[model samples]
Target: MRSETTPARPLGLTFRLDEVPAEGRRFEGALTEQSLGADLPGMVGDLGYRPTGPARIAGNVYRSAKTELVVDGRVTVGVGFDCVRCLADRVLAVDIREDHVLVRRKARVVEEGEESQTIDDEALEEPDVETFSGEEIDLTDLFRQDLLLALPMNPSCDDVGADDCRDLVGERAPDEPQIDPRWAPLLEMKKKMT
Candidate 1:
C-alpha cells in the first residue's frame, strides 16, 4: 500500500550520501511495529498475521557507481497467524534477504513526437532495481515490501508436536450404491441389461 509518487519522508532508516563512505558502509537498525506505521497494519491484516514484535534490519550498502548503490540486507520479524487447517494461532519467525540496486534518477528531455520511453529489458527482468532522486535514500518501503513478499501464502502448523491440529483416523465406510432419483431409470435399464 506504500506509494512511490508521494514525497519521501524520513523513517529514521535513511542513508544519506555523507553516511556512505567512498568504499560504502554497513548499517543496522531495529524498526518497531509502531514505526512501521498504519500501512503495515493494513498489510498484516490482509495477510492474516499479527505482528508480535519489532523487525530488525541489517545490511551493507556498497557504492556500485558514483550515483548508484547496491544494498544487501536481511529483515527478521516475528508474526502470529492462524493455522490454515486448525484455525489455531501459530507463531512464525520470518527472515528475508533483500538485494536491491538503487539508481539516482536523472532528468531527461524529450522532443515532441518522440516515442514514450519504456523500462529496459534488463530492468524488467531484474525486479530489485529502484530509482531515487534525492540526497538521501529511504529504505522503509523496501523493508516493508520484502517482508510482505516473504510471508507464507498458506501458513499451516503441521509440524511435529503441534497439538492444535485436528486428528482424523483413516477409515472406509461400507461400499453402498447411491442413485439419484433422476438416475434411477438409467440404473434400472443397466440392471435389465446385466
Candidate 2:
C-alpha cells in the first residue's frame, strides 16, 4: 500500500482533471445501478422505483474557468415501477436535457450558496450543486439524481384512459360502513340532508 501522504485514486464513474483536452472533451457513457452504488436499485425513496436500463449520458465538458467545468448533456433511462392503478410492472422512458451542470470546486459552490455541505435539516437550505475536488470529477451521483427527478409524482400505465384505469380505480364501489343500528336513522337523515 502507498503511504498516508498518497492520495487515493478516483473510482467508478470519475474523470481525472488531467484527462480533459485543451479545447474541450466529449463524454459519452452509461451509468448502471451497481456502478452508482448502494443509493440505487430496488425500491428507493418515496417514488419507489428502480432503473430498468442504463442511464446514458452524453455531453461536452469544457473548462470554462480554472475552478469550474461547464457540462451540457441529456440523460435517458428506463425506470421500472408499479402502476398506481393496477399495480402492474411498467417502464418509464426518462429523458432530461441538462443545459448546464457545473463541476466546480467545493469552496466555489459554497460561496455561491447553491448547496450546503451538511445533511442536517436546518442546514439543508438549498438543492445540490455538483462539486468536485481539484483532482477529479465524479458524475455518478448527478446522473442518478437527475433520473430520480424526472419521474412523475403519480406513475401508472394509464394515460388518457389507458387500461381503463379511471373505471377501475375511480369508479370502484365504496366500502360499506358498519355502523350501529341505532345510528341508522341519523345516517339516513344526514344522507337526505345532503
Candidate 3:
C-alpha cells in the first residue's frame, strides 16, 4: 500500500536544536485499518468488520548540539492469532518500546579532521525510530515493525494428534520363519495317523 512520506505528516515536530524542549513531549496517532492494508506481515486479513485496537505511542525527543533529535517511545498493538486447538481465533496483544536517535546532517558544519560518531543521514531515513531525519520523521515504519514481530512463527491453528503422526521412530520388521525340507514327510505321516 502507498504510505505517507516523512514530509507528508502534520507539522507537529520541527526537531530544531534550539526549539527542542528540555523535557520531551508525547506523540499520539491511530494505526487505522487502511494504514495496515494487505502489507501487514502476518495474515491479518480483514475478517468482516474486525477492528484492531487503537495503538498507543509515547516517546521523548532529546536534542544535542552534535545530534539533532533523539527519540524514545513505547508502542503497543493488539494482534489476532488462530488458536492451536479447537481452531478458534485467539487475540494476542504485544507491546514494543523502541528508542530512536536522529542526527541533523544538513546542519553539520564539522571540520574534515573532526572525528565524531553518530548515525548518518541514510540510516535516519528508515521507518523505525532507530534513526530519523532532522527535517521530518514518519512513524509508520515503527508501527509496522511492532506488528510484524508479534505474529506467530507457525500459521496452523490445530493441535497435532498422536494417531495422525505416530510411528515408533526406529522400528524394524520381524524376520520370517524358515521350514526344513524333512518336515514335509513328517507332516504327511502325522496327517495319515490323525
Top candidate when judged by TM-score against the true structure: 1
Which runs of model 3 end up more than 4 angstroms from their true locations?
A: 1-19, 41-51, 84-86, 105-129, 155-194
Off by over 4 Å in 2: 1-12, 35-47, 106-128, 158-167, 171-194
CA RMSD per model (angstroms): 16.0, 14.5, 23.1
Instruction: Give TM per candidate.
Output: 0.67, 0.59, 0.50
What count of clashes does model 3 give? Answer: 0
Candidate with better lDDT, 1 vs 3: 1
* Per-residue C-alpha lDDT of model 3 across residues 38-61, encoded as one tens digit per residue: 334223222311226655565565
Q: Whole-model lDDT for model 3 versus the true structure?
A: 0.47
lDDT, candidate 2, 51-138, per-residue tens: 7767888777777766566666678877776565555677777778774535444432355656656323322333343556568787
Model 3 residue 75 CA deviation (Å) reads 1.7
TM-score, prediction 3? 0.50
Leading candidate by lDDT: 1
What overall lDDT goes with each candidate model? 0.64, 0.57, 0.47
Top-down TM-score ranking: 1, 2, 3
Using alpha carbons, what is the TM-score of model 1?
Answer: 0.67
